[model samples]
Target: MATPKHDLPDDDIEYVSKTEMKREMTALQQLGEKLIPLDKKQLATLKLPERLFDAILAAKKITANGATARQKQFIGKLMRDVDPEPINELLNKLAGLSDRHSAWLHRLERLREGMLADPKIVENFVNEHPSVEIQQLRQLVRNALKERELQKPAKAFRELFKLIKQYIPEPALPGLEASGPEEEDEE
Candidate 1:
């Protein structure tokens, strides 16, 4: 295949090619799809144009596969008119937050598992989190272990996770702590 001729030398031309533009639009549409699954509060944080926001809301309501695909293409077209850099940045931040939240939850799960496997861990946990209710946590752990042994419904096991989440303060994300205390003052 022959290479397409450029009007000027590659270095002289500053504009993106048609193919590159199409790829960018496609990427933005995929970003829009990701945003669709987010709740209203999360979507509000993006600060998208009114028309584009309405389009996303409408696209989300579309259940038919063919129509949804078509709407997504339309959204891509709309995205071409808007600056995608900020949108991409925000999406990356949100994704990072989700990853951090998942890691935090996994850490809690491992702590719970460790406590259950070794009763001694409970003493260590109570010592670390002095505000935690020791008796309540111990009772829950015991019940959770019994539930696991009997292969019954995991009610106590789930409760143990909830209790752990409540008692153990979430590790603050870097850079977020600077603005942390000020947020409470605004409210």
Candidate 2:
């Protein structure tokens, strides 16, 4: 083999080896991942029809008014080209959850009133309802107690029920206790 000399003025030389090619391949793969376009299925996942779409569109209109023509186009294409079934399902689930949460909140509001009327219960609530901000809970408690005070007949009925339950629990059951195992274990 002839030993190549530097005097042979060649402008290009092979510097890229298998290791460098592999490194380049990995870097290109990462870049390709970042550049990959969202498929129709992935796009459809965000076009939530009910509450989520309403929320997103409201926000989009507010923020996107300042965006350029290309940005607007991109957003419009994204919204239209995507599959929306997942979004609809998610929104339905969220709406259901919201309804359940609201029912719980109403129950909590009723409980808050009961607690406010009873100082002991109020103290217990103040300690237990950690998620309810202290100031907000205090205000709600005040309102509930005031409303309860305004309902004289209801208050009286509740008090009477409490008293009745406290005193009228003397009924006896003939056989309420468990009768142990029914048969001996085979294994």
Candidate 3:
């Protein structure tokens, strides 16, 4: 059996090789495909080059699978010409924000569960979040607990989750806060 030739010295071999380069390009192509599903506004947030951005928009308009695949390949080629590091970084940040949002939601679920399990937890939550509507929250919790005991439809339970979510402060998506209510008022 023949051994593969090393293009760089043994120490430098740890760096990127031809196989790695191909893998990176494939990954970039996959990322481009992922971007295609995003709306135009979301794509604009990525700060992509005008040509690449135009290609992505054009790609989104294609209905044929074969043409879309070809357009994705073209986007990958364009990705190679631009600096992918910043693009990857921004993607990672967005992913991290999504993870944090999920975690925050989970925390709210746990809090709701804890409140249902112990009456004291309700007092504690009310104390911590004084701005919360105490009477409404207590009513929702009582109704949810009663529904659980009776095995009725979980309407109250769902409402409790909605109320809990309202209390939890969520981080806004990038580029959205700027154009929110304040911008509308200015116009």
Candidate 4:
């Protein structure tokens, strides 16, 4: 059998012992398995470096008196490289704030602004969906226009609308459960 080629320089190859090579091979095999289905674009977007990986691993190891595994993982990522003093102060200040739809409204404004920029696309959409409420479509376009001018991208707004559509109760879609007979009145 032919000798196996070492990609590294002779000096570097000599510096890495056989045990190191075996360990590296195992790591590569694991990485390949984890990454097989990810396309180049998805891989590029991960932005994971050695420091990020190390930070995540380190975060995973921190345990408090009653922290769960999921909570530890969440706090680890959220707290990584964050300063505690100012964050605590901010949290204290915002403690009274309710999780309302206001933030989502802001996001919707951003989406509206983006849609207005592409007039042709908007026109085409309207043409395609002639039965859709013209006033509603106009409102959507106007909101997108406002968001773009404010320098907020429309993605957040679009996401907010998508979430609303998904979560908010709607008149049942076609072919869903039919309205049944009303229950008899009890004494």
Best by TM-score: 3
Candidate 2's residue-wise lDDT over 1-187, tens digit each?
Answer: 9986896467666667999876755553332222124333332344333432333344334545455334433444444433433433333333444343345434544554465567676556557545545565455556545556786334433432232223223222122221222121111
Q: lDDT of candidate 3?
A: 0.74
Q: Give the best candidate by lDDT.
A: 3
**lDDT accuracy of residue 43 in candidate 4:** 27
Q: Tell me the whole-model lDDT of each prediction, alpha carbons only.
A: 0.73, 0.41, 0.74, 0.44
The reply for model 4, stretches above 4 Å from the true place, is 1-114, 151-156, 159-187
Compose the digit string of candidate 4's lDDT tens values, residues 28-135.
433333332334333233344444344444544556635534444443444444333332322222342322323434444444444556666556655765665566
Clashing pairs in 3: none
Where does candidate 2 clash, by residue pair? Answer: 43-82, 44-82, 44-83
Report the alpha-carbon TM-score of model 4 versus the true structure: 0.23
lDDT-sorted candidate list, best first: 3, 1, 4, 2
Lowest summed lDDT across 10 adjacent residues in model 3 is found at: 178-187
For candidate 4, the per-residue lDDT at 4 reads 94
Question: lDDT (0-100) at residue 13 of candidate 4?
Answer: 50
List the lowest-lDDT window of 10 residues for candidate 1: 178-187
Candidate 2 regions exceeding 4 Å error are: 1-86, 89-97, 129-144, 147-187
Error of 2 at 124 (Å): 1.5
